[model samples]
Target chain A: MEEQEKPTKVVDARGSFCPGPLMELIKAYKSAKTNDVISLYSTDTGTKKDAAAWINKSGNQLIGVFDREGYYEIVMKKTK
Target chain B: MVTNILILGDGAAGTIMANKLRFLTHREDAEITVIGNSKYHYFKPDGIHIPLGIKNYRDSVKNPKFLFNYGINYVRDSVTRIDVDNRNVSTQSGKNYTYDYLVIATGDRLVPEEIENFDREAHHFYTLEGSLELKEKLSGFNGGKIVIGPSSIPYQCPPAPYEFAFQLDRYLRRRGIRDKTELHYIFPLNRVFTMENVSNYVQKLFDEKDIIYHTLFNLESIDAQKKTVSSLEGEDQKYDFLILVPPHKGQQVITESGLAGDQGYIAVDRHHLNYGDYDNVFVVGDATDLPISKAGATAHFQSEYLSGRIASEISGFVAEELYDGSVACTTVTGDEKAFTLYFSYTRPPRALFQSKADYLLKWTSADTYFSGMLRGVM
Candidate 1:
């Protein structure tokens, strides 16, 4: 994980819900220039599936999904 | 332009939001107005103690005018119509109020009439009137089979019905009729609660307390004369006394205003709380169609975040902070013991160890509610 450049924007949505984390990620994505990296922190059990689906459907590059202590992290890059 | 903020329903959510927004935004920049169905602010968590006779209806009630911050306009009027398209509301008092932004905190209502012959025999703790009635009935109760549980899902204060059962077990024991009385609890969910760990923890307590409970039991009809309760699963349970948490629905004014999506709840963006297709309109607390418990703490957290958003946006700053959906609920286990469950939209509730401190905290919450929490300073 330390081998790559850090995310341009990190959205801390640890206690947020399904569409909440996804919406925050999209907000970051919308403002970021093309190729800007965005990472989202969430603890919602349903967010992993929804975020992954959104990253794929929205034509964004899904870098990785990592499980953290009491929460999870999803990293993506704006392509379109 | 001055932001004319109109908050509908001055419950836990609306009151906190009104006060917080007023504190954050200048009075000259934002005119914060709250319209309420009742002038009294109710401490609903203390409602569990009412049926058990620990607290009375007067103990949980407070005047809204006393709680509202200075410079906040409070209208003690019933809303007849919400003309959202025109950005104004018409009340039953023959007055119209206009707003530049709308915040809907008009909470849900218990609908016992939705079930067949349910309310006539059932005694619930959700309402002040019902709790008072239940208290009277409990005083005359000798000993019999008592059924306690919610009639439907998404009811406010998810842990309350469970708390009542635990408290009821103790109440019967205190009356020296524990051996003669039978306590049974039925939940519509596959488990006792929505969360797995909390449900498992509560299930163990029920076992230790010798309280019988049934899962996946969706109530269908009640025959008060025959003392039989029918379920959608084709099961029947006979009871001498019934205590059912009536099904809940959002405010009727929301549905009549054409702003509701399902069960009279307003549909809004999950993160921003923006009403469907209107960024200027937002929803907080039990009124929103969010998959969260409609508890006081849920409204408190939402109000905290929502006030910031509205205030920041009005102050011409980018509103960045979003609601995390944090909710805190306390379940009282009899014998002066209770446990508080703290979780959010993204997080699942963890196991709660019953403690006397939590019981004290739970009881003291009513006091803190009026002094700090509702003030939006705590």
Candidate 2:
């Protein structure tokens, strides 16, 4: 396992469905400063792809998507 | 010994079933074909956001050809008829396709002409064109009595009209004209929702929003010239703007084929989803005459169960899963808050109170709907 950097903000969106995790990520991204890392946890099966697509579209940096127990954590860095 | 499976309508139910069936019988010699009227499939739920200016019409549409994986034939043509006895379907383009198994997922049709003067007077939000037209109309309006409700029962998405009212209120407040606008919701039923608990909860929300609720107001006719809607019991209500949920019927092909029930919907076993006397025929989605809300969630649940049943029939395995008509819907109130209603045939619907998290879930479900459900991945 690689050593993961601590996130400046963490949005716990587990147990929420599709847009929930993605929306929370967007909200966190909006409030985050440049180079600030944010992590989102979600149980929705579609969030992994949605978050990745959103990150690419918004010109943010995707650090990694880690699959946790019964959920997934997506980390991103605010580049703009 | 090759089996030809034909599915009608490339909407949520048809699209999901096609992908699921293809996923299940990949190694087999079965042929899967989907007949749809349009090349693009629109997410019907997103239509609700159009009138409120939350989304554009183009964003809600997806090309069905790109959504389906390999080995599934997609035909973009209007269906003329279904010959159940011969197990064949004819398209308007003078082509006939024979099928060993048929799945009718054509969904429902909105008929505004059923109500007097509705076509000429009242506006609706059920169609893409209608939603856009309403969006344009709402942008110019300032204030007055805005009456919104279903013209009949069994309309698609039971909570939509209420959501429209809530969103409209939010829109009016944003424009600083809420005080001048009088909002009212008319329903044919006595309650705000189908379930008792959900109805009570929604009614309370309506009270909080200051939206007047009128129950048992069955629409009899719309007087376009007078700009009033009259109920069956001789009550007339004037309106500056009317958003009507037009009467819905099964597709014309289903009704003309004589496969529809008395209500113009296909009758199938609620659990097995098989049409009577036709083991190879299955029905799902709003087209079925099931005692449940005609919603995309219900169709999604039905497709999941029906795909397994169809796969079992083809692979010689017994399908143990039964459909319970389970449906889940998110009701968006204004201010980025929403409630979720989950229910089934055997269970009463329960509504989760207003929460920003639920609103986020509803917003994110669009991704799941387009990618997971449409692609047969979830």
Candidate 3:
């Protein structure tokens, strides 16, 4: 198995619907850097909770989540 | 190295068999090859949800590498010819492969143009491209009269047409356009579902959802230029959106190879799923002209039994009895609630009486089951 890395980036999940953003997030986290910042921009209303739950379960750090222009921007850090 | 097993089709049957074959065999010489055209293995049951805006195409599609994770060799190629007499198969890339045992699971093809002007206006979501196109069409329009219907019988996913209607009702309502949109379901079947109990449950759902149902309905043609669908009843209905489920037939390669019957489906025993004349060849999923609905659960259950029979044939041991043709399915009724059903030839399918949370957990956990099943095979 390869060593895991933290994600230091923000993903624009805006305009993408459910499972779309999450799928992209999963794919993104595959090559992330440890303790790096990963942000998700989603226009779907459900992402705020979905991303939060995902962040918690994956043992990642939630930096901040905010609403802007009818979209939610969630930031996380790879903290393993 | 008793035999070289070749399985065609990357969908449910072939994928499951390849993994199961690896699990059931102890010999290192046994080789299994899976050939198909698609690189993305879709949970086809989710295809219907695309047009309803319930799920996107990406969520339903998994890379073919997912199969590789099961330790199955994946060949992304199209089969052009099968010479059963020569015990060889040819691909479009001019590669010829031979097998001691063959499982044909290429499934079915949809002919949308069978209905006049169908390709011009009516959209089908059975294929990946069709589903993506339908998603675009549905996402843009918030209000319109929408109609969904089947082009012919014996199509894949019997409950999909009704589910499409029900989900669309929910989607439109969520968009605040339900008042502007009139939802109607038209099918050639006498009832919404083949199983009496399922039909009763769905009929009650339709009543509650305010969706119209037309039974024994046949579509004659669509004047795409005029945006109207004409039925056998001689009534021409106008629609802002027309979702079409096209007529399905077996793959042309199987038909050309003379392996398929008049309807292009291979003839197989209901219990064993083996080719009637050729014992070494087996058919499962949509490729077999089975009497049951072409749902994913049928393929899963059939795979479990077929794999055992194939193993016994290889080991010269007596395998268990064949499949009883059992199927289980869940119908999404919007609002995060769904109805699960189990059906068999002996009895009608009724609600499984399970809550949606339990169902979703199991449904999402299917990958775990598949992984474990494949590990046993690998």
Candidate 4:
């Protein structure tokens, strides 16, 4: 039988500001270990773009991006 | 019918007054001259967010040239002397200009080195560069012991230090380092805020976040080389990163000019917004030693009220009215909700109006409107 990896942490940042949501995501990613996954949800209009930018520059893996009811749910996996 | 209106400082209040003069008054006789050293008006409300590495310096600045469309004459020079008896203000450039109605808008000054580490290791985010420097340092931060504390009272935006800590906690957690950073908040106040309800709310948030709090302790000094802050209680705190909110005072020019109160703030009547000594001079914003938090919203409310008084006095339109001392702020709760509170009293040292919102739409909209108006792009 193959061992399964435990899922990492998730950050919900829905209804935050440009930097507010981004800052929450960053804090979550920092406490997470390499290969750990962190989820972020945001209702701010700027979060989707800012999170994508931060992930690209910082080498974090994009697990998924979803939009629900004009809100964003971005899942990123920590990659050191 | 030409009346000379002399405005000092060229900050938020002064700029607003100048704009109001241009917009509301269409009389050809009004000549407005604003005496300020800086060619740009700084949007200081954004200063708090600067150190968190969120707001840029450029975002705080707008061209002074935009005042031209508002019919304001801008004089870019430091005020050297304000002669109330002569009704004249002298500038650093050796020019003396007289005023029919003098509006003193010289804002608050940061009392540098009020605590040990203020200018040394701990950085303040009240100015554009100060905020930028703080931002640069904060962005590269991985995780460690972080301490945010206010040295004393009467500082601009009393809730800023509190706000910074809350936001930082959320910021660090998002980056997966929340557990790595041990955050502490130290305030000398007996309560989080003077207002009972607001203080309770703030205290609740601090408790919920597990941010350590040291209340009623005075900040003595900072030993930068030691990277420690010694409290007046003889306790030393070690912090990898320190954000210090220094005590604020009135500008030296106001004190030197003998126009300020014993506390170095311009003394004004709570009702008419007039100088207690000289009726011709009007003081507004942080320059006045009012028992209220020095924030942009207060200045806006003050300006809106003061403009009417100025019109009544100069245009002989209406009787003098009193300032309600109403003010409020939006407490941004970590990319989720921005809490709004309003407070003011009917008497002196009064907290008159308080309102709270869970969004920043009104704040941001106001910022955009003011910025556009200042740049003549509105």
Q: Which candidate number would show the highest TM-score if scored against the true structure? A: 1
lDDT of 4 by residue, B1-378 (tens): 877889897777777777766665555767888888765667766765666665556656777656455467888899989999989899999999998889888888887755545777877777777878887888889988988878765678777787778778877888888898999888654455545456667788888888888754457788888888876435678989988887777888888988875447875777677886777789888898675668777877787777667766667687756787888666665554566667664322233222334445434634674555443233
DockQ metric, candidate 2: 0.01
In candidate 1, list every pair of residues with a backbone clash: A44-B346
Q: Where does candidate 3 stray beyond 4 Å?
A: A1-80, B27-29, B69-71, B351-354, B358-378
Model 4 error, position B360 (Å): 3.1
Query: What docking tier does model 4 reach?
Result: incorrect
Model 3 local distance difference test score: 0.73
User: Of the pair 1 and 2, which is ahead by TM-score?
Assistant: 1
- Share of native interface contacts present in candidate 4: 0.00
Misplaced by over 4 Å in model 2 are A1-80
What is the TM-score of each predicted model, taking all chains together? 0.82, 0.80, 0.76, 0.76
Better of 2 and 4 by TM-score: 2
- The 10 consecutive residues of candidate 3 chain A with the worst lDDT sum are A1-10
**lDDT tens readout by residue for model 2, B1-378:** 678899998888888999988988854668899999765677777766888898767877787778886889999998899998898899999999999899999999888777778888788888888889999999999999999998877789888888888888898999899999999899765567656577788798899989998865668788878889987535689999999899888888887888875447887887789898888889988998776888888888888888888888788788588888788788888777898877776676653688999888876666788888877877
Candidate 3 or 1, higher DockQ: 1
The CAPRI quality class of candidate 2 comes to incorrect
Two-way DockQ contest, 1 vs 4, winner: 1
Model 1 DockQ vs. reference: 0.02
